[model samples]
Target chain A: MPELPDPTHETYYSAAVNEALDEELARDPAVVLLGEDIGVYGGAFGVTRGLFQKYGPERLWETPISENSVVGMAVGAATLGLRPVVEIMFMDFIALTLDQILNSAGKLHYMYNGQVTVPMVLRTPGGAKGGYGPSHSQMLTNLLVGIPGIKVVAPATPAAAKALLKSAIRDPNPVVFIENKRLYPRRGPVSGPDFVQPLECAEIAAPGSDLTLIAYSAMVPLALEVKKGFAAEGGADIEVVDLVSLQPLDTDTVFESVRRTGRVLIVEEACRTGGVGAEVAARIAAECLDVLEAPVLRVAAADTPIPSSMDLEKIVLPGIPDIVRGVHELMAW
Target chain B: MEPKPIDLLLDCFRKMLLIRRFEETLSDLFERGALGGTSHFCIGQEACAVGVISAAADTDYIVSNHRGHGHLLARGLDPVRVFGELMGRTIGYCGGRGGSQHMCAMDHSFLGTNGITGGGIPVATGAAFALKYRKESRLVLAFFGDGAANQGTFHESLNIASLWKLPVLYVCENNRYGMSVPVSASTSCLPIAKRAAAYSMRGVTADGMDLLAVRRVAAECIAHVRSGAGPVLLELETYRFCGHSKNDPRVYRSREEEARWAERDCIVLLGKRLREEFGISPDRLESIRTEVDAEVEQAVAEAQAAPSGDDRCALGGVYA
Candidate 1:
């Protein structure tokens, strides 16, 4: 393996995503892109800015505003040996594509009995921190978590964003890559182009002994911030675990952390009901009930439509204060 | 029109006859409770399947929908294995995982038939995109019912295929009904082929009952697609003789209409052509019938004796 670059050099999350796409397109001729306004428009979020000019129209094909057919097209192309990475502008718009993504792309391999594989990636921006309102600002990772055939991955940092996307593009099955709009502009150190993060593992963002704080995507950085505040005040040492891969979640790391800390708290930007935190809490209750010091707690967004106003959005979405308060409640319990 | 070679006509006739017999046997089995689950039969639409498939190259790809047994049979897949799939045996095309509506033979380049109405349209368009991107000469043919033309995917996929000029042929088996609701009731357009013109693509309607006519139209459309003139929507005006499925009462249509369609039965028309045009004797036709009946009987017997799919492997192929 080649050595990674120095950690001092940093790049934005969106740039890291662009770098991964550039490298994969150059690496494999079969990796083509299909989406609405992804070509000359440089993508809705600018993640695919220079790719259109670099790869030309044949590689970076623009599509109409048809989400269902675009995804269906990707699944069809993938079966025929092209690794198409489709961009569904916002994660909210994925509702228009559930049939193709869940039924066709997800079930084709099993339905065909392995005669064909749909090697494709659906990259969409999700999460609530953008204040994009009810339709666009949904952290819909919960919707894709329990699906069997499709894999869902959310990256917290620039490095994880780059590495996880590379890994998702290379996976032989359909992978729904959820990118948090809030994390797009955040800068962090990314490894070399050869680095590919494992799709079925969690990373301990920070280590501690007092409590375990589990989060993912945009919530990971917030959890880390809460951990840092506690460290500065010499409060309870909280361990932050980033659940990068939502589907096929790395429960071993979570259970181990819960056992060590004896207290656990799950945080997410998605609604509390039917969120990834609910599944994690249930798993901890089922498997690590004996080791827990208190009930597993969760800090998630309010169970209502995310508002557009900053004040209302702040109250509805989980923030640093909510994580701190949850930790305090867990410690008190 | 000029006649195709006698030998080729004979082969097409045999394939069409086999599909007819296969669907008839399936309908019988379904009625007897010997076969479980629903099956959509292409009893009267055999020529559309055989004619279009025969007009294409062996390497060309095919995407089919629910009423797809005839399509698979015409593409030269084993009847015994297809029967085994319906019988839930491990020797089937999908190892008994996919039922009648969802069987794939990738080695033959026949993608699996979809249960969704217009599900295979965009997939076929995408496959054509892949072939074109790789600079291959092969084209993809997608089959769907007239009801599917009203689906959003049909319109969306046609636009993309036309814009990119993908090498694909969208073959609509306009059997005039979408499971009891007639095309006139569901679709806004007069003929589904006219909807193709909205996408700036070639649209043609063929006489689906006549095997030679369908073959001629399919040949032209296939040649047009293979030559990279973008996708063509070829509507085969056909009808179904039986109920949509085993449980369908088919109260929507009358016996008079059914009899009228039966008069133009594709099998009978091809038999007449073979007797008059090709000089094939009735005794020879009877022998061919006997041969096909025996083949179907052997297939049914072998499929019945085949081992049931193992329950332990139920979750094996969910991922790559």
Candidate 2:
């Protein structure tokens, strides 16, 4: 690993993503951006702001409202030599591009027997935020985590967002960088442009011994908040682990944490059934059953579509209170 | 129109014959249970593949679809390697991973053949974008069926290619039917080439059964694309003599329609042209057929003898 960059200044989550794209576009000529309104409009969430003026139209391509073909185009470009980072605007709309992403992009490398590599990154903002409703807001990370060839990564903080996005761009395989819509405005310390986090590892955000909370993306911060509140009240010393890479998951880190804590809680923003939490809980049951003191619990959104109203949306989505209650229940058990 | 050289005509005829023979062999193998899984053969659409690919430069990229054996052969892939892949041998183009419909020969500038309709259209468009971004002169050629023309990818790719002026040739081999459904039933537009005008691009139709006519139209479209005129949609009006796959009983069409297409068999049409226009002897053509048949036989034997891919290595190549 290269020397880690010292913390320079604080940056917003979306701005950090923009900084990584800017640095990559400047560092490598093969890097290009493609998506609707990504060029002139600077992306739906402004994650690609000012890139159009900096790199011009050739490098920053503004595509029409064609999600399927746009991803297909990125896959094609990646195979040929260009490292295309495609923005699908919202993770919900990735349904339209599933054929290209799953069949074409995800299967091409294996199907071609490694003759081609899709060195591309699909960056999309997901999770219920600002009451975008069921269509615009979704934590569809589960849809991609089960895919074998594709890598799925979600960054919870501004620094990790920058480092992971940069690393995702440099990876040779297809990577789905899931960005939570709600985390965009949050600010955190970011290292210099040279910092790059590994793609297949988990970071221990807060260390404890009484219980462990495994979460990713927006849930990581929520898990940390629960831990902070628990420590302030002199409750159980809960540990928080941020799973940066969801697929090819760092099971070692998770297993190690589970063994030490004995009681574990898996948290996610997706719905309760068939979510990433289920997978984590299953893995823990399989490997750490002997060490576990109590049955593993999960804190996730209710099994329902996100409503447009913030009140209804909060009810459907998991929140800090839910995590707090789940932690208390696990400690009591 | 000035006549093409006799040697070039003869080469095209030989290639079409090879593809015809290859498809026939695959059908025979499937019947005998020698090969598993389904394979889509471009039996009657040989001229379209040969004519369009022959017009392209060796460095140009090609994105083919499910019915792409002729396209791969015309792109200069080794018959033995193609056979090896279809037979599940490790020596295949994709190390036996990608079967008939999914093989890719990157060294030959041939991208993988897609199983989905219009799947390769956007891919070729993207390849063209890459070529243009790097300021390369080479272009990309995408092949899809008539049914694929109605796919959203076709329309989306053409629009992007035209808007960006990407150098690519969109070849729509309109063989009348997309599997069981005929073009007239599935498509709302008459003459799929006309759809190109909506994207502000040039479009043309060619006699896909006639090698010379296809070659002529493809050459013109290739030139237009090579000159950075964006992309062109060349609709090759042709027909498939065989059923959609080997299993179809032709309940959808009459014998008369099948006979009408068989009479215009691209291989036979080219052979007749060679005899009349190029003054080629019938015996010489017979020798070429004999030579190609023997080559196909040899490839099949070699592919059969080659070892199957190891099951343990199946997990490999899933990521770079």
Best by DockQ: 2
Query: What DockQ does each candidate score versus the true complex, computed on alpha carbons?
Result: 0.86, 0.87
Candidate 2 stretches greater than 4 Å from native? A1-5, B1-4
RMSD of each: 2.1, 2.0
- For residues B1-320, what per-residue lDDT tens digits would candidate 2 score against the true structure? 64568878888989998999999999999999989999887899999999988877888999999999999999889999999999989999998899988999999999889998888888889999999999999999999999999999999999999999999999999989989988999999979999999999999988999999998889999999999878899999988878888777879999999898899999998899889888899999999999999999999999999998897557777999
TM-score of the A chain in candidate 1? Answer: 0.97
Model 1 deviation from the true structure expressed as Cα RMSD, one decimal place: 2.1
lDDT at A310 for candidate 1? 76
DockQ (C-alpha) of model 2? 0.87
**Ten residues in sequence with the least summed lDDT for candidate 2 chain B:** B1-10
> For model 1, how does the per-residue alpha-carbon lDDT over A1-333 read when each residue is reduced to its tens digit?
123355435799999999999999999999999988888789999999999999999899899999999999999999999999999998999999988988799989998899999999999999876567899898887778767799989988888889999999999999999998999999988877788888988888889999999999999988989999999999999999999989888999999999999999999988899978999999999999898999999999999888988789998998888889899999998
lDDT of 2 by residue, A269-310 (tens): 988888678888999999999999999998888888889999
